[model samples]
Target: MKIIAYLDAGRIALGVVTSPTHFIAVADVAPDLPTDLIEILEREDGMDRLREATAGRTGDRLLADVTLKPFLHRPNAMWALALNFKSHIAETGLQTNPDFPHLFLRTEASYVGAGEPIFAPPYSVARAFDYEGELGVIIGKPGRDIPVERALEHVAGYTCLNEGSVREYQMHNRQFGLGKNFEASGSYGPWLMTPDEFGDPARHSVLTRINGVVRQRAPLDDMLIDVAHTVSYLSRGYRLRPGDLIAMGTPGALKPQPDDLEGQDLSRQFGPFPTPGLVHMRAGDVVEIEIDGLGVLRNSVITDPAFEGDL
Candidate 1:
């Protein structure tokens, strides 16, 4: 079943989306939910409990009339995957760093819900803000040193991740984390599909669209390190708590290349402008990140802080 966290009217809620026009309210089955989505994921057999709770009440509600919030609330942290795509390395003209699993962090505060507005930081601290559409791995269980063979067992499911970056802050810090973790920048989810629905995370299709134009397309097999490998590797040192998001880095065609600079004369050699990096977000731009099975997250960019409401 496809599960979604939505903001209907003015209240936030969890829903079971069965089809375009049908769904069942989790509250109708198990009313007065005390815990958030992350907490629901951490509990033992929470998936089964969610299924059982919503089982007998399917197809009783209409889908079109209601709105969707489509974001995970209060995840522990968002982890980054660098150089996970082999083609990405070749495209950028950089030899693969020997580092097995390059990692970084985006604070929880940076998250924005699907259909929500992405704020442009007022200070103009970053001129080259870029987008990296990625497949998000949502961990369901707490584990330490999880074996590679059983890594998938710890995953709750997958969601769409728009990994926005500020090239200025990122390169200046000499660390990827601080640059990527700007408040209200990253966007996630319309729903968190269960593993049963998201099947074979290792092999799937990913596409990125800017203003309804397709820009990047690749297969999950192209990943140098797949989801299972990332989960197992990450669990080795960091104790992956429930609701921790693991972004399985962007693939080829999205990374910056020299060819994009062929037509126009660049003013400066370094910094945001002439780099031919990923698409830079601005006011009124709608960016869409879609996975083959999971739903699409449609969001618009706006600078006004008034646009944000509790999700």
Candidate 2:
């Protein structure tokens, strides 16, 4: 079933999107979306109840009339992939790293809902905030040393994610988490579609656009490491709980850069040759990431004073 979090009245309400005219009240059947959602994903017979709850509801409440928040406001941890896309490596002029998957972590502090404005923190600290459109896998059950063949079984559903980044901080800091997990930076949601509705994750098309231009496009099949191995490998020594987010990875795209009459730094030139460009978003730009069946997540970029302490 297609589940979405929306603004009902003034408070955030979670509901299922059945059509433009109908929205099943999640509260009427289930307590809350984030907390109660785990039960729905794990229960063998819960899908029917979910369908029954949202079946006949109607009007503005049905469509995404309100804003969408992070599916899991407090995900235990955020796991992300870097350079898993071969095209991303070619565009960035970086050699593919062999051996193990390229992984990184973004904390819950970065969580922001769709339609929410992403905070462009203090200029000095993060001059280049970039975007990485990725397909996020939500693990439904707890498993250890899972086999790749059974990986899809543990999956609860799928959603679209924009893995925003701050180039300067990520590269300069000893650990990238500080720059990667800034408050209100990571925006994703609209809804989480169960595997049955999602079909084959690998067949789905993931596209990212800025303003109205398509910047990146790739299929889930392009991923060097598929979902199952990723989950099982990561869980080798750690426990992957119900709400953990596995961000597959992003493809190649053109990004913003410092200009100097095209003669400043030869290393910084963007000449059709693929090199990672900092796709910085200004205060008014709208960024959209769409995954075929899952749904679309759009957010406006905004500037805000730097926030101190942890978000």
Top candidate, metric lDDT: 1
Tens digit of lDDT per residue, candidate 1, span 188-245? 8877888988899766877878787665677878887778888888888888888889
Regions of model 2 farther than 4 Å from truth: 9-12, 30-35, 39-48, 55-60, 254-278, 305-311
Give the number of the best model, judged by TM-score.
1
Q: Candidate 1 — worst ten consecutive residues by lDDT sum?
A: 262-271
Q: Number of clashes in every candidate structure?
A: 2, 5
Worst 10 residues of 2 by lDDT: 256-265
Mind sharing the TM-score for model 1? 0.86
Off by more than 4 A, model 1: 8-11, 32-35, 60-67, 95-99, 254-277, 304-311
Error of 1 at 176 (Å): 2.2
Error of 2 at 71 (Å): 1.7
Q: Report how far residue 198 has shifted in candidate 1, in Å.
A: 1.2
